[model samples]
Target: MKYLTIFSLLAFITLFSSSCDNDFNINDDWADITVVYGLLDPAADTNWIRVQRAYLGEAAASASYGEPDSVYYDTTAISVYLEAYSRGADGSLGTPVNTIFLKPDFTSRKLDDGIYSTDDFRLYRTTETIEEDKTYKLVVEKSNAKHPEASSITEIVGIQQSSNSGFRFVLPNPNVIAARTFNGNLKWYQSDQAEIYEVDVYFYYKEVNRQTGAVEHLVQKLDYTTIEGAQIPADPFETIDVDGSPNNIYTLLASNLPELKPNTLRFFKSFTVIIWAGGEDLAKYIDLNRPTEGVNNSKPEFPDIENGTGLFSSRTSIMLDEVAMSQQMATTYYLSSTLCEKGFAIVTSGDTCYCERIPGIGPERVCD
Candidate 1:
């Protein structure tokens, strides 16, 4: 999920506000200047939109946003909404398919108070299905204001699936023993509108009670590896590279599982691969918010919103779960000299031996 913390951005703006003092000159009349943030994704059942007012001056800027109600708006005073536009049967643009109000929902949020806020941050939410090949716009308005305080638009271009749809497994090749080690790459074809990609592997396993000789299925889902915020330029047609090293995979299991105990036994289960991707707006938002490239120390202006500040974007993720280990590889967890040395527990189900780790992998079982 994308976090839209304005306190940090406010602090950052404060740091550079002096240099660009004239850009944010506060009027004595205290006319409201709104700050908005939201990232839309069809994959999510509930979408969130965060709205806050921009503050200025040394004293207000330095104040911790963690304090209750310091950086949020009154639900009665503000209204947030979303509009979806899609093409019709004729393939020509038509009227908005839907216009929905984002309802208020409050939950404890760790925000940036120059550090980060830990209070309940208020947000507007909707269950609208943000569809593919559609355009979405967000509008925020104050009850007393004549016009929307903030507004932004984003295009929802769906992510293009790879030939294998991002989950490709490297099964044990009959001729290559080494094939038993490597878990193939998690790959995807980039969307024409996507600019950032993330890949991760989840290894799931179980722990056992040696004393009772009872099995505890689904103990942990270890994040074996992650490739975060990878930049992909040009048309995203070719396959993308994700970590697929066997050594690292073993190391992760060994480190998490640790030394075997007489009181416990663990078993290896299935593994999952996930690919998270973001659209062009998210990429631009990242570039604008990510640390500066050089010593220049200036911040880039955010461009998506109009007559206001912050971001409006879209994202999506794909997952492949319960991928089974090759028989050769599963067997090695117990009998292979190389894998046995890693401290993985050897457990038996009937007559078959499977490797297990502890602390453990997310409580999801890997198939034997």
Candidate 2:
């Protein structure tokens, strides 16, 4: 198994540096070996019990998810995560070094089970210079298939030059550069104190079709203890410039989303992104009425592969600001154009490994 993780990480860096104070520490506890002798928690069915917190990257936001009515808002995905670490030296788990992966815009990269949190372990984000108290470590791993591989549930917080909770943020959280690539651009991650809040973005187009693999998404009913009273927005916040500024980017309107009738080139490629940082003074604005921008533009059911069979996909919702350190406020949603390779066998592309075969083959490996 990869030379047993390189000989147990070279016998733990040759027995903890061999001499430096002849010391040894990193036993946040739990380690019995299974992947050839790992640590943290490893009884070895695969691993279980995940969901931890403790993070505070401050602020940065965005959102988008169409049709709050007529059904479609599950926001699916979010099984395990909280692997942030700043120091723990060896307690294993939680090792991104500086750490930061909160994800917003509804968490679209799969793993959005609502920002995930079982409890404790959350150094989530914090590193301007790294001083404060030092400590650092928040690890929790489960879900490879999830069965009981155990290990990873360690927390050792510290660092508070100015921290009331875990503090750190940033990831592909701002992604939406362009799904089908028409008029797109939505990026977030700029928080000094989060100053101004009044951001709301939502776009939708699900139920495409790729011959009929069957698909239709978006039913995120709204939970997490009512999501901070259903999304802040009483008005009184405003600090997110994007710097390159211009308009922020908004364009879509087939009569402002006539239930999404695109001409199909891939107009909406099964999408999702619902963000409302602090909410915008709520008079009730979730794309106003919703269809996702449009004035002269056009493409909903349009072009979907000439207009049929694509398997549909979409989700993006972000309402950040729990400040980590633990839980109480978290929601993630992100799932971009994934035919995942329509069951694998006839075709799958994105540069191979969509995987399936092995029935007889010597090795053609062929699969788009």
In terms of lDDT, the best-performing candidate is 1
lDDT for each residue of candidate 2 in 150-248, tens digit (9 for 90 to 100): 222222211122132322212213223322221222333322112222333243334434455455543222111112333423332321222211112
**For every model in order, what is the number of clashing pairs?**
13, 98
Candidate 1 residue lDDT tens string, 135-213: 8878887797664567888876464433334323333222354443335434445554566765566666666774687
**Model 1 lDDT, residue 179, Cα:** 45
lDDT of each: 0.63, 0.27
Give the local distance difference test score of model 2: 0.27
Q: Candidate 1, residue 81: CA error in Å?
A: 1.0
